[model samples]
Target: MGKLLTVFTPTYNRAYCLERCYQSLLRQSNRNFIWMIIDDGSTDDTKQLVEKWIEEDLIEIKYVWQKNQGMHGAHNTAYKLIKTELNVCIDSDDYMSDDAVEKITDFWMRNGSNNVSGLIGLDADLNDNIIGTKMPENLKKSTLFNLYNKYGVTGDKKLIYRTELTRSFPYPLFDNEKYVGLAYKYYLLDTKFEMLLMNEVICYVEYLPDGSSKNMYKQYVNNPKGFAFYRKELMKLPFVGKKFKFKQAIHYVSSSFIQKNRAFIVESPERYLTVLAIPFGLILYLYITSLVLHK
Candidate 1:
């Protein structure tokens, strides 16, 4: 038997968009993967809809529910239960192209994984518009800093990774339920493994009006403590180079300065003060982000 691929979807209160994802999986040209849904405490009819799919037997589905812990928590649960050689995450509101699995599997088969840890692919919206097409060239195996700063790899486009290399995001880092900076965790695997960039578009991300990034400003305003936690974690990444280290430090200090709550700053006064001395923090942030394009 060939190695199984587990496609994990972490969802919360997104019943309306969930079907698009399920339907896409049902139409996949390849059926060697299992669709694992980790429901993060949705009080809506999400469970009913998922159960209906299970009854129809449209695809190999596993529905797991847990108390509301946030996206990372749901991912942690899914990662633990997925018994597949390779794993991928399709957001609840997103779906995959019909040929996505075939393309990914074929790439793995041909490449033979001498040093590849996972695969990355183009992410598009429901309209099939490219999301990060203009990202820096030769971004394959770029550091987390390079990904977010130089290239816009913050979005959900990457594909299945080796189960052994995946790690759970540290729970203490998140103050509320928001999921930011989680992508930084992927850098942990970058040192030993490089990702294969499959020029093909595989995932379709639905831009939900209420998505996490939509309320980013509010998230930062209301949860400065959590934002502070995220900054500290980013600074500690072993794979990040000096530029990202400085950028992360600047981000933390800037956020503290903008929020003006002095609590986290008071707690880490030395670190916070050091960031202000960097001299061109805002300019650097803008320059790095402006490089993203859809080419």
Candidate 2:
């Protein structure tokens, strides 16, 4: 019989952190799942580390290698190869709780419906502490934007989706803009059907200095061009047409721009002044973003 869930880990050169993730999977209460590792051209011993685990017969591990194409590329590869009804991703630096698979599987068995496109679970840290357990009481039918803006979907909450409904990440080279990349895609899916909120802690996110979120500020400072691309794409989404989208866009752009580039503005007056004439507010949010990047 085919496995019910496909757990994928999109890893770079995080051989040091992959062990915890593999160990977590080996400890899963429900073992009827496939572990797919999409290695993004790691120069480290990642391949050998995974091979060691595979030899132990710990779990059904399948490893694939590709050129250094970034997180989105690894994700796209995993989506194409995953052969299960449901899919979930835990970063290589992160691990899941022992009963996570069991909890997710049980939730699907009891409530999984053809109309339901996916499920969302609570996420925590390396210490097994829940980050956003205090989610809104009624999240089962909330739109993707509402979940993030209102309900506060921060940290690494594990979201399980139907393999068919999943879409590829739009931007592959987005540096500071990685957060909006996949998170927004999931929200777009909410436009068609609602995802179930399991309200249980399933995964733990490790705080690695090299992790995407850690270097977000530097990414913004170095490549304002990437932010411009992100802002343009954000406006193109259909959900962004809703009233909430505009408000969220304002908040998103202003916070990211000011927070990351304040130092640059002080150090390089001419560079910052070049884009200062651009209007502030929603009418010119995309324009200002482009100016910053181009300046």
Candidate 3:
């Protein structure tokens, strides 16, 4: 009876670029969605700006402020607060397409069901070029894991999830680390459900210089435990092949070294693989550390 979708954005001090996302929402042909902002302790004028937008009353907006926690923590908050049947995350620096809301709602209304997790849509760059290859036209549904590893789909795709599934596997926060792979929850979902593919570009993304994707070596150094936890989980996924598991084990070993976790071998979900990965992982750890140091 109410809005069927919640388009939530989790942000930090991204006030300068956040307006691009806000303006995009205002242009949506379908307004059957609400915009929820999780302000992850921005020191900038984010709160004041959002307040001004709220006063405009142009779109349904819900804003919540929390102390600085990383992106995953803000996601945890968004999942907790979203009350819609479906939800999607459009990052602070990314904006939706003009007809994105229309495409999503119309597609879901016709084809959505509880049997599937939700839909996977495309993301493009500012130049209107698809960020990577498009989804396989013949493939109607696949787990997000399979979409890349098996089906050869490339690039960052937009995910619209049922709120309940996302809330099921909340990411664990480390003592001082701010990053855990966002894919932790998504991988968990893959164990139970596959996502329907929609080859339309629903979101446009611009990778900012300060964005997390650009600073992975630093993130690896700072968030080793978090990275280890994510890799361990990925190693345990039932559907992936040994090659995939081996690769994850390599990362798990690297992260374990970074965090200096002595029990990584014993604690590993795949102990044998972890042992084999140790040499490569140590090299990777040194490589990452060197990159960070040189920077």
- Per-residue lDDT tens digits of candidate 1, residues 1-295? 7546889998999998898898899889988888999999999999999999999997789999998877767777877788877889998878899988888888878764647677777788778888865345555454434566556555555656877667544444354545545564576566666676667788888777777776565555555556666776767776666665666666666555545645644555346444463456455434433443211
Question: Where is model 1 more than 4 Å wrong at Cα?
Answer: 112-114, 134-156, 168-177, 238-243, 254-295
Tell how far residue 198 is off in model 2, in angstroms: 0.7
Off by over 4 Å in 3: none
Top TM-score model: 3
- Residue lDDT tens for model 2, 188-243: 67767777877888888877999877765544444454554454445456655445
Best by lDDT: 3
> Model 1 residue 205 lDDT?
82
Per-residue lDDT tens digits for candidate 3, residues 150-251, read 888788999999998889999898898899999999989998899998999999999999899998889989999899999999988888889999999989
Q: What does the lDDT read for residue 140 in candidate 1?
A: 48
State how far residue 228 of model 3 sits from its true place (Å): 0.3
Indicate the worst ten consecutive residues by lDDT in candidate 2: 265-274
Report how far off residue 22 is in candidate 2 (Å).
0.7
**lDDT for each of the candidates?**
0.71, 0.71, 0.94
